[model samples]
Target: MTIKNIIISGASRGIGFELAKQLCAENHQVIALSRNITPLQALALPNLHPICFDLQDQDAYKGLVAYLTEKQLSVDVLINNAGKIINKPFEDLGLQDWQEVYATNVFGVAELTKSVLPFMNKEGHVVTVSSMGGVQGSMKFPGLAAYSSSKGAVITLTELLAEEYKETGPAFNVLALGAVQTEMLNEAFPGYKAPVSAAEMASYIKHFAMTGQQFYNGKLLQVANTTP
Candidate 1:
């Protein structure tokens, strides 16, 4: 496979870190973005460029767009993996909690995507990481109403974007991922053991990230063997 220029959000750790490692191993140029890029810098891959920025910061997202534009770089794949979770029951959750979750999961993804659209290759692929909880009829957990709702919003946003960009622009899709072993998961559910590992999820994400534009668009992929 020809090397592709890929941009991955939340690349400091977890699934994002693995995605950067595996994609760089495949000789792809990876632009890794995260609030803390120190971990990414430690990777020391020649093809990996680490950008430190909070996805919730609109100015930072715009700065990234400026950098890409100045370099005349077009991305083959864009992975929206940065997300925030507020694990509080529906009754206990406040407006701030909801805003915090949506800020990172939905608003950030949308703003960055809008800025990056011009830098996407004609056949570029856009993959947004969502949660299985966001998928209707899937398993629901207590204290995840805010998190689930944010992810669900992104899923809808992604599909709408896919339709808007269907004939021209890039292809867009959503991965309503199942329980994956990651820091976020542990934070959301203490002592919970997930069937899928972060590395495994990253591998699957790479597969779809690389092939989504070529095969499917506007589809919500359920990346779980069984409902959690």
Candidate 2:
């Protein structure tokens, strides 16, 4: 397999952590970004580069760009996997709750994508991870008013990005995931068991991030077997 420079967000745990580990193990140049980098740093893989990054911080984008420039690494794949979810009833949800979720899930995605576009070319792929609850007509969950809506926003953002960059190059797509046995899942739904494990889902996402652009662009692929 060809080694490519890949960047992924939310790499401290769950699917994101697994994805970063898998890619680095494959000898790919993987830059794993998360607010907490200790987990990734502990791995000490030569190919894995961990950066402390908070998606909600606008200034962090400049640091990322500087690092890429200093390393002279042009990104081949960018996986916007960082997300925030709030499980609160619609009536009980406050404006701050909505802002916090959207800040990470939506605004952060858009900003990061924009920041990395210069490092990508026609061959580059941008994969934004969404949720099944975000899909139109999908079964709706009561406590995810803010979470689901924030996720939905990224789906549209991905489509618009794909269109705008269609002629220039780097393809964009969004993956609307189903229930996965992740810490996030446990937080969202206590005592629910998801059929998919983080490593399993990470493996699938790794494959897609590397090759899915060949067949898909401006598309929303549902990657779930069951809803939570």
Candidate 3:
């Protein structure tokens, strides 16, 4: 396996945190981004660098890009794991609620990735973590209308990126994950037991983030035993 410098968004907890932990254990440089990085800072891993700021903050985004440029950092893998889910019925979902979800889930990912592209290695991979509900024909659950719509947008965004970068260097792909046990999942489906654990999902994401582009480019992979 090849180990290289990687950047992970939304890494203060859950799948993102686990990914940072595992990757840092392997001696890869992991730049973990989150709105609150106190939990990450508590880990105290030398290889784990935590940056605290909302992805929607343009100043924070520019600061990150500047830091990378000043340090001459070349990201080998960029994982867009940061996301926000709004669980409200379609009618109850206000415009602000939808905007908040899309702001972090879609626009944030796009802005961060765009800023990093100039600093990414030619053979690097850009992986976005989406949801199974975003997939076409997937079973739809009520109250997740906004969340699902944002993820669906991400899938299409990733597909278009794959095509746009086909003849280019860095490969783009999206992982449509099924129900995974995490704080977010628990909040989304209160008391429901998800088939996959956060650790399991993190391990799979680590593998794909490290090597999926070798076998796939512009692909939407489903990482769950059950779909929808």
Better of 1 and 2 by lDDT: 2
lDDT of candidates 1 onward, in order: 0.90, 0.93, 0.91
TM-scores, all models, native as reference: 0.97, 0.98, 0.97
lDDT of 1 by residue, 50-105 (tens): 99888767789778988898888988899999989878879999999988998899
lDDT of 3 by residue, 79-110 (tens): 99998987777899898998899999999989
**Cα lDDT for residue 21, candidate 2:** 90
Q: Per-residue error at 45 for model 1, in Å?
A: 0.8
Q: Rank the candidates by lDDT, best first.
A: 2, 3, 1
RMSD of each: 1.0, 1.1, 1.0
Off by over 4 Å in 3: none
lDDT of 1: 0.90
Question: What does candidate 2's lDDT look like per residue over 47-68, in tens digits?
Answer: 9999999888888999999999
What lDDT does model 2 reach? Answer: 0.93
Predicted structure with the largest lDDT when compared to the true one: 2
